[model samples]
Target: MQTAQRNSLRLLQWMMVASLALPLGLFVFASAVSWVSIRETADREIEHSLDVAHEHALKVFETIDRSLSEMAEIIRDVPDADIVAREQMLHLRLKRLVTSLPQVKSAWIFDAKGHALVNSLVVPAPEIDFSDRDYFKAHVDADIGTYIGEALTPRPPYQGAPFFGVSRRRPSEDGSFAGVLQASVFPEYFESYYARIGREPGSYFALGRADGTVLARFPIIDRDIRLDRNGPIAKLVAANPMAGLITVTSPTDGIERRLGYRRLAEYPIYVGAGLETSAIRARWLSTMSQHLIFGAPATALLFALLGLALRRTRHLHFEAERRQQAEEALKHGQRLEALGRLTGGVAHDFNNLLTVIRASVDLLRRPDLAEARRLRYIDAISDTVTRAAKLTGQLLAFARRQALKPEVFDVSRSVQMLSEMISTLVGPRIEIVILGSEEPCFVNADASQFETAIINIAVNARDAMEGRGRLTMAVGMAASLPNAAPLPQHPYGYVAVSVADTGSGIPPDQLERIFEPFFTTKQAGHGTGLGLSQVFGFAKQSGGEVAVASEVGKGSIFTLYLPRTAGSGRSRQPATDAAAIDGSGTSVLVVEDNAEVGRFTTDALAELGYAAKLVGNATHALEELATGAERFDAVFTDVVMPGMSGIELAQEIRRLHPELPVVLTSGYSHVLSEHGSHGFELLQKPYSIEQLSRVLHRIARRDVGQEAASASS
Candidate 1:
């Protein structure tokens, strides 16, 4: 028994030792992997910085080379005598050239004797001798084509900042060096550009000659510094002259860096971009410290848990199961609570609308109601019903199921037209600025809904600003969304309408919930909170999206992005003369699922001088049409119904009748929202009598015109 006990004790000790060793090994391996990843990411960042610097250098050099070539061509045929004689004219030309190029400071034409023939700085060429200048001397003996000389300070008469000369050897007829045409390029130009591109802390950009002559360095050193020919960078260049990566200490600053260097393809110049090794290492260390901070504790906790688990496996399992059950119960309760809030909000708004309608109807029912009072009550009821419809429409919009009549229209022009209305809506205290591209940006969407969305956003902006601030609405083109996701099938790209305001701005926590229905930050009665929700839903339903950005103290900007349409199709302007829309007793087939609505529609149609017949569904309507009992001018149908939807029915009627016009009407149809009106006129639900009459009359007139044309043909 003693021998067996001893062996078991030894086995337990070995197991514990193995467990500890395994975790330690894993921690070390993970640390190694993280280090490698961090280094690689740092290297990639450095390389990217190098690429930006290289491209900027190329652009600057190309511009300079082109300018030099143009100047060379202008003076190519002119003799030295003419160049001296027409000094003022040549100087003016050079001045114009320099003025055009922001990078080039000045231009100078030197004779073979190194006398300044013409200078852009002064009309009569300055009595300055360029014989001593490096650029002039470089071109004196040999035709070096184009020479980029080292940086030089301006001499006495010619005064400005330190600038490097880019010169071309002016050849004589015998192929001998005649003179030099030099353009003074300010080092500050390249340095300023370098400052913009290399923005990382401890980052550096250097423009240098192939022979270690430093022309410019960003972070502008107090004194000029050149690279040593025997340095690591020079050795790296000697090995790979075109481009390379180097890890070395700066001879000037003595700070070590990981650098990426590139040589210009044509020019004998190099552009180097680097981040201090300390920064890179610090980044790596910071990342590693984070891993250590989390991983060490986690590993330690895992070890403690594993040890405890070995001792009480069954107990731990029971505890885990209990915790999981508790979590699930908590989540379920939260979901139910959220559902209650949503349903409660919707019910409250609808009940308020119903109460107004009920009170209006009761007042209208008074036995001795005054004519004005009765009209006022009736108008109140109408307005209440419209509000109710709008509330439901907003809900449907949030659900992305609102039926929309999409048409191609210019977003810029729409904003411009609505600027006056927006100004009034926001109030006098708020300054409204309308900005848009000179070129029209077209988008395919419901124009009315688009206007509503803008107004909704503007109202929110007005409230956020407390009615005093600047509200700017800008429309422009965007290639992709903020998330960098590519658009689909829209070769014309996307149109972005951004509404910005100087307001109190939204909290980060509230931003995520801003689009949720009835989620408002305002006090009671201040807002419905469905404004942004409507904008969100409308954007999504239109194959677009809305995004917002905000800071607590700064303001907020809401941008709606819609697919751009290449066609320049503007929204049809409302007919100014009502007489143009003539019904003229045109026969119509009305397809409605509701009995009351169908009866009301038919009566309204007849009252508007259109002979009408009603059917309960598309099947009955189609059957009636198939019978050919009467020639119908158009088919007005509801979109959503039991069996054979209005859109499908319209397609069927179009196929069979070919000449009949189909007008679709809907309150909210998922099909209609997802797929548009299918080339049919659409009348949204809750439309007024005037709106209904106008639609029917327009279709009727169109049909009559088509019939007349057919008969004539």
Candidate 2:
């Protein structure tokens, strides 16, 4: 039985390893293939662009030659007529024909005398006309047939007339040549063909004639490009090959362009098509880059799956593995809950102790002492109190009771200010890098809580590094959640502050439990185990969430997603600046349920020189107001008491007094419960003597009108 069991276990272990190893190896192989494919794709695109341009150039040349040949054929079929009569009649007909064909610049007839006989243009024939011009010369060379001449443009007198011409001899019945007929087509006729090539932004095409004249370009050519090397169109067709490709500077943007050129024996000129190399390659570049980017995470996931399979294969005891996991989780939770209780208890005791210490410090200051000695004692007291306060804050964080008084703040500024403090706390052995955001992301959260949470996470990161590693703190908006993981729900939009550490990564077994209170991997006396717990609590209380992800031997990342507040990036209100209030003295009645607190308030008001009346219950207070015998400026009362609720009583008083000022106060009172209402202000309990004096002073100074409510509790 033992032998069988051992064999079974070995088989399972092998299966797991094979499962994991195969997929991981496959992923790495696929990634290598993908990279190669991307490079090859770019190369292929460049080649394809060259091929298309070459084809287009050939087509354009063919079309132009075909059109010219057809015109020549028509001219050749016309029988010869009397030279003088034909010249006069032909001039009128040729002008109409040129007008009918927009591409035709001019059509003329020349006798062997080298004088223009008739022409499409209204200008008279030149005194020194040449019937033996290149078009006529070409026709003569071809016997009595038609011939298409090379691209030609007026050199001087007709400088703007850049065009190509075709010539044909009008033959007599005996097969002798008559006066030659010639037609010139302007360059603008080719504009439509060039415009068809590049339509996308950043893409352009140009046509360069064999002689290096840029016939047309989709985008306007620049002056600088005229000074540079001619475009690939001209360069490729320069040798006058049937078809070829080359690279040259663009005539528009001066960007290097690749062009395909084609020439034909039928036409005297070569045609070239140009496309920007970058534009052609851009499509494939984007495609391959996208594939490469997606491949990273895809490959990672594939390997992870394989690793999971391998691990399962390696472990034959499936039941035991599950049991182990459950046991660990249970232990983690219990430990955390215990830790929370422990921290809470410690915090409570410490606060009491701190209070006593503070009282003693205050009392000690009253006694006379040596100036230097007193200063030293005072410093010690302040230091101790401050440390105690910090400790209690950590406890509150762990307990999820930290106050979240959120307001707009600049994330970058906060990070920069904390850089020095983080360095000091993290120690010299650890490197701290603080990266800040360029744009401000504001959050409505308690700044102190936010600061503390970041610090706690940093401390945890430092600890993970075992005091010797690099830690990076960054503030930025959360990346849109990928399809695989939807964004976790949040009360407010999120801004993520992340702490990353290059140190010992968390074990898989401990990852899920890291945020649990009191869960620690460190030995006793080395850790409190509440660092992450406090971070988690603080995040949750602030209407946010904390997430942690890690891999063994790699590293860990902790992200705090906070609520985005309205009016982002706005300058925050200064906490120390007080809103001023002025008051006019009017008769006032004070109501209180607690004697010491009440007397304290009344006495403070009396010292401020206000005639104040006091009562104990809401009913009596309301009755006093209902009676017309006495009138008061404001009704100040305790909210929670034996007789009546403060809010209800306030409602009644408002109805009765109508114009009286009613302010409620309480210790553990929800007197300010808005109840879906607005416009009232309730003073908090344990109010200072000065604070009460101010409240009355303001109330007395206000006008008693049917203003409803100006503030709310």
Candidate 3:
């Protein structure tokens, strides 16, 4: 009790010090603030103006861009119109665009020879040639995308002012460059918009090219606005093209202004909007002149007032600080408590899985076990391993380190195949209905992981229904997903797999955090909270997204969106019975650092009628190959080992033994990224005997074919 009293007294003393510090600090700050310069005010104003102007510029550019793109699309898809009729329709449309948006000087459609096929303004269009124009020449030679060229002036009476051509090259039916669909936008359009950016007199706003060519400027001093590449503003813009503030003296007026500038991300143009620093300083000085008079008096009064207030609030301050500390301690405890709960939950789930495995193994140890009972134990063990693999897969996915073995397959077909399995898993009480679109829904991703994600979602829905409701899996095409990341068929289509359930839906508070790792709404000891997280991570890593919508007491729909693929027709191959395939004394060198694993590989190879040799590392394998290359027909290597990686060993083998086949195996390897298996055969770990037989057969066939070709040569 005496120790508690002493601690309380010390806390009170510290609270008193803190309470006094605030008022003293405020007094010192108030006194010192007058001495600090006001230069940043000008920069702040300039930055605000630049940001606003840049936004407006993007909108304007987008408007013009969309207009041109639409026009081009229309002309490109003109659907069997005669040359004369198409030209007339194209002329009218272009004219409408130019009139609607005053910024568009003209839109032109021209053939490969630069002959003007149609123009927006020049009716009975003159036989004008744009052959000399860089924008046209660029498309004619080789244009990968839209080209923004330097300013060009009309030869005759057409808008004496210069215009920059933003052109997209037209492709022929044969996929060859055919023509150019050009939008010539006037500089005056940008200049007019920029004029409103500066409220102060002599202030400026301008747009320049990435290559330091001034395109347009406000307060039109003259037409001769182009400067040398080494000019101050040009140099500044070139050095920091994305965004920054730089003081530059106007070449026309010789007035240095604080400028805020940004380079347009979509286009090769830079925009700068600014106000004169001198004008800003004058305005600030005028406003602050009155405030300066009361500084000393105000500071003195404030210090005295705070001293009295602190004295009166001493007890309150001590109580409040003590209460705050207690609240913070409570929150920290709650967080730690929450973490402990999570740990306990994960540990309990894993322990249950391990118990399943352990019990299954013990059952398998009984010599008197019947064949059917033994099979049941094996299935249970396999199921537990699968569950454990899923847990770790989710962990790896959350860390963004799970390697993908992507192949294109139809999502609709995969769903159809999984329907029966899902029905059996969910039990008879839950009705599984699959609603597939008539159109093909294809995706490029790891088929196994994709199947796992769908199963996880399906299982989640099943649980939500408490094993007694309808679960509907709807497959179709989606235009946009919930996230901002770009996918395979961006802005066009995506393969969507939605699992919806008529269950007691989740509350809004819990719904938002469903995708977070180890976040579950299930009762403790029932879930590891990694199911939905795996779904989330797999979708994201495959360049897609997962979206969930739930209504309380009604139902919930969980959708996984994957990028659309053109269906590489790479279906999952059904493994044949391993016992049926004869390895026929084909020599296989088993490379694994782990003795148990290496022994297992060799035993399996021997069981399949293949003569096998065991090597501990890449060094031994390389030495074996060096001494007798003909003795080994293939190398079955583990991906991650001590000295040299399997991929590196594969590279070495490819260099030395061009004719020999190398098969790499890994459940998950840091070194075996998707690219590592490009030209080499891969046997995923936990592979069935049938899958092993299937890969070996394929390798043998490939070897025979290579040998035949070499003999023919």
Candidate 4:
């Protein structure tokens, strides 16, 4: 009896200890998790602010570049004497230009001797010699393209805020440096824009030269501050010149911050945004304190109710699982948000293009328009249409719905041929290295799309490396993919084309989403974010897959795996410029649900010398065909309709009229993308009149050939 009592007492003591520790441990773990989440949130906010600063900086510099280009054009042919004679008139023009751009403080044209010829700041410009100025000196000897000078206050009597000079060297007719066209860009303009966007306290923005000279900054400082050449931020920029994120202490203020920075593509400028580490830590501390306030009481209550501790622990586990589920739901919502952004971006671009087209059309309708003006309007419309088509094509490529013409080609040869072109595209700073296996790796895919994919990947690598890095393109064969299922044609193996870059790698959070449409790490206006997505889609649509492996601060490698095919592979024949054949005396049956489209189709066919009959829907089309009142040479129908889809209609027509040819058309069709055109010729929407005429003519000619063969038999 004594032994049993001792054992029971020990058991109760141990149970009590576990009960107290369990809740305390859970509280600590939850607090740590909360702290991490808060830090990540702060980091993302800082990164977004950096994106805004980058975009603003690019716009500011681009406007300056445009203004300089205009000035250069204005004086391209004029002699120095003419410029002196037209000084007053040019001064007014320059003033107007500067006034239109809020960021530009003034404009000046300096002759080769550094004498001010014309300036926006004063009429009958003062005979000020700017030979001592850094911008003038920099361009006096060499043509360094565009030179963006450090911040400097204007000569005493005429100043508001310090400004930087963005100048381009003007060339003489003999290709020698003739003068400099300079624009004074106000740093306060950028500072004001930054202040508006960065409303959070302890946040800062800086615009600096690649060589560490500060051009503009928010939280304005009185003294000039230049970054140390060997400092953490400068080293980071040297290592990864395009863009990156870092956590460091600010040398000027001694405050630790999490900073994100991007370097401009065409200029020696860098934009950075950072959040004070103290502020982030304070937020984390506040959140943890609230959790502790709530958790402490609950922990004590559990300790008091030791008998029910086991049940309470189980409930806490259930809550944790529920929280995980909620987090997953939040991730789904984020994906939806991304999709919304993609749609909005697409809509915005299309709206702008449409606006241009509408204005051009309105102008063309004017009765008093000159021939030159009319031709310009027509050309504008044509260019807009072409751009619109390219946009839609990119979208289709991302969706994996583009109509591709597949052919068997040697991947190794293609890479070899593209190496020179890639070198040219990426510039001299990037070294292009090609590695190919002795054995030819053949694959069946679209030749043009394959080339495009390679170029896109190379361009992406260039940006990631900031135009200076080694890009290795390797072609070989692989038996299996890294994270993909075995291909249906596994017996033949796969052609693996890998592109490796020594550049800043993608972050862990962004690695999985690199292929998402409209997702990019590049600064705005420098990328459309469709390149990798296009690569992804083209690979998948070609019965292959694209895989990426990246390590932050190291580099990245993107590999495209295509199913291998036997044979040496045939060379792609050059496309001939075929003329549209006349469609005289041929009859076409047009099946379209939309009234306006049907009318347009009939009119276009009539203009092309084809007799066409239009019907509202597939059912009516079938009825008209059943009547046999009018013999049809060919059937042209849309793929998508209200009832009995065009694909189904085509199938029915083929079943009844075994001798007739059918052509299908659509801007986009899920059926066509997924199941193909059911062995019929397909014409894409927005096709030219010549294309329409040719397709109809081909079918009519085929029908005639068939009839003649039957008669001869």
> What are the lDDT scores of the predictions, listed in order?
0.85, 0.64, 0.79, 0.86
Poorly placed runs, candidate 1 (over 4 Å): 1-327, 438-440, 484-491, 571-584, 701-713
> CA shift at 409, candidate 4, in angstroms?
2.6
Would you list the rank order by lDDT, best first?
Answer: 4, 1, 3, 2
Question: In candidate 1, how many Å is residue 58 off?
Answer: 47
lDDT of 2 by residue, 336-404 (tens): 887676777566556665775776577567767678877776766666666555555565666665433
TM-score of each: 0.54, 0.39, 0.57, 0.52
Per-prediction backbone clash count? 0, 18, 0, 0
Q: Per-residue lDDT tens digits of candidate 3, residues 1-713?
A: 99999999998898678666755565466434632444665667678878887887787778877876886677674432343356776788888888777777888877778877788875666777887887788787675576777888886656567888888877456666667878887888888777766667547788877776677887675665666678877787678768988888888778888788898878887788887777766766665554555454565688999999988799789999999999999999988986786677568768989999999999899889999999999999888877777676776675556778788888888998999889988889998889998987878888988888888888888888999999999998888777654533464378889999999998999988787767877886666788887887788778788889899889899988988865357677754444446788878888999898888778887898888899999999999999998888788898888889888999999899888889888877765543547578988676666677667766864458768899999
Best by lDDT: 4
Q: How do these models rank on TM-score, best leading?
A: 3, 1, 4, 2
| Residue-wise C-alpha lDDT for candidate 4, range 608-699, written one tens digit per residue | 78889999899998998898934888989998999899999999988998777888999888788778888888988877667888888777
What lDDT is reached at residue 195 by model 1?
A: 86
